[model samples]
Target: MGRNTRKRRTPLATKIVAGAAALAVGGGGLVWANFYASAHEDHGGHNRTRSAGAQVATIDCPDVGQKIRDVPDRARGEVDGELATMDSQITDAYQRLATTRRAQAGDSQFVQNSILGPLKDRRKAIIDRIQLEINRAGGRADDNLDELAGCQGRPADQQQDGGGQNGGGQDDGQNGGDQNQDDNGNGVAGPVADDFIDINDVQPNSRNSRNGLAADGDGGSTGTFTTDCGVNENNLFNSDNLIAAPGVDNGAHHTHDYVGNQDNDAFSSDEDLANADTSCQNQGDKSTYYWPVLRLQDGTQEFDANDQGGGAEGNIGKILKPAQAELKFVGSQQGDVVAMPKFLRIITGDAKSFTNGDANANTSWSCSGFEDRQVTDKYPLCPEGSQVLRTTNFQSCWDGQNIDSANHRDHMAFVQEDGSCPEGFQAVPQLQVRLAYDIPTPTVENGQVQNPYAVDSFPEQLHKPITDHNDFINVMDENLMNEVVDCINRGEDCQ
Candidate 1:
């Protein structure tokens, strides 16, 4: 468990970046070396599979999970180098992120947006390097992150009690229920007719039962629309487009699905996005709605265990497009759907869920061909013809005013039992996203998959499959919103 304390970052970005350069050139040469050369090296060939009897155990303080002792020497050394340098820098930056000043007003927006997000990127990059080394070393990583260089994250129960002290344990955004439970714990359906099943729910018919439910309303005023954002192609082209808060040109922390605005980021003005080209088929509709990219991993992919670098470009390298992009929009439950303001940044889900075992990762998994079975703790190993599927739903009720909030979540609330917006907020178009993929069956060791599954995430994710979630933002043109309002107010079904 993590101790309750505020983590302070004393390292400057320049020092970390420069130190990273020095390490690449063998500057600190073993000065910070923490691991001894694995005795298992030269054991004949590379990619040697470990025997089921291979021993794995956690070392001491700072390190957390059960470490695999069968790693190759070269790969172990590579991972160690990153741990001493990049991982060290990442730890410092993460402390800075937890304590940084939030809320950008006017011109200060530049610094406010630039601060933590960049650190997030750097941390993710460093972690990606570690994951790659582990993959090359021929060892699967344990999701508990017990093998991290100096990071000692507390369990969720400890995190909740520790108040998220220095350099470990996130707040997890949980209330009432245990945040550590899968998929945010027993999900409460919002005002939508039939919301998708929470990915981590273990109950049977979790998917099928909900799929059959119909959205009911006064038959006028509000309407929901879903679109297909084609699966992403393999490329470094930035797609994590929140365009605000940690505003960068290419969606710095993670990539996203861009509908409008050729150039989008936190600094982008509504006019710029409205005038820019779009990737969406609705050319007249200059709106950007995006969440994290979902991917299917083969054993060869360098991954941490959870979806860390949420963007498709950086850590994931290239991602095979999902079978479909399930995008749904919602308006008021009883009144006419109102028009959304231009350049609205509405984020949902925890993009960093790749590293957590809390409610944020409350995921539900399934197989493409086998729809009846749904698993929560771990994804079902898809058969020869089936593909693994993942889905996440965001909160809907809003405070009726604030476009963005301090924590980015306080202003939003989930709909009540009847699908009505909470007392203080009116419903806008609720955005629920779904992603599909094809994955290879992982190697099982001691009754567990050895190769950690990675989402485009940072090195610390530990590759735990249970931790899965996403984020979102809505940047729509004024006219396009009017069309949405019109469709909802008049009960017209238009794509």
Candidate 2:
């Protein structure tokens, strides 16, 4: 556990643009356009993979899983396992980089020849196995996967906004300021002073007017249902992700705070989840909700301080429990919403947004009293007495059939700018989570940060707030799910 009294200070880089006027409405309901540079494409694949760098801070590889689509159901299990192995390969390679910092300083090509080269060879072998599994299952695997096997090193000083911090492509965002080594104090890299901005400096970005909808007898489902799931006061923490890497231990490479269903790990089957106990006050709602734990980068060491996903991997500090965890389900603005299928799983935001870009980034940060103002890529610096808030609005549109997908994202879709479900998709009750933390607000002065807070993340991600994400697996009982849908359709607020 982390001690609240621990005091540590981190330094920051110079400030960038306050906030970009990035939100706008077009024919769609609401549009958050790409205000910063996206991850490098043209790697001969769907997405680029990033790695640990020397002067180059990290590695960059191809995200093979994102490109491997339409696999036969029988092959998905083996393919998923191979994907997990690839992630492990990267983690191991990153460890090599961190430990050999001395060698990296002396040898210019040490990272490329010794670290990245070996990782690529390992990844190539795994990519072959993934393709074989799909082919054996009678699915046509893409031949270009081999091209993605090659990984490159990123310059530590190379600045471009993607992971977190910045709407206007600024090199100052997260380039580690003037420090040459990881100043985050944790053994790993990132959350440099450049990664944050004062919340009060951010201008208001307009959202949909219908977002604050009330029960006015509109065409849409105007009601809401709130579930009382106590914050993980039971201390349910783990680094496993059953949805993305089933049967794999420490797949996430970072610890998560789990709430709702008590039995949620890499091995929990749908049946196991249905029968598990829940933290929610309502026994009928056994859904599992989890997210990366937020930690203050103080000197206090927690349980995982020496573990792979914890301090060993550079995610040190004390874990802070949320002061308030409010889970509410609301209806679609277009029409009445249907009940979500049981066992439905949704992952909001990208855990690799730092390297993968903001295409899938959906996080929001604000101060408790300044809820009207929100920032997606930066952590909010709340005013004194005002707590920090992290909010996530899950995708409300379902593909109508599958409860999950190959990439764990294809089954669900966010409502379009017009606030309507896409063609062939059904609008489901949208889950909105508001998590508030009562930790001391971090302050930056003279290029130094005092008591900073960050979400646990993959070592290479550098604890970027944009990489913060959430997970949910709906296991609500049929009767209770019906009650939720009915309540929303009726425009009544029921808890």
Q: Which candidate leads in lDDT?
A: 2
lDDT of 2 at 11: 16
Error of 1 at 147 (Å): 27
Over 294-321, each residue of candidate 2 has an lDDT whose tens digit, in order, gives 9987767577665656665666678999
lDDT of 1 by residue, 406-465 (tens): 334555665665666668876666566656676554444332233223343332332234
Worst 10 residues of 1 by lDDT: 183-192
**Each prediction's RMSD to truth:** 17.1, 12.2
Model 2 per-residue lDDT at 39: 23
lDDT of each: 0.40, 0.72
Stretches > 4 Å off in candidate 2: 1-54, 156-186, 206-217
Residue 147 in candidate 1 has what lDDT? 32
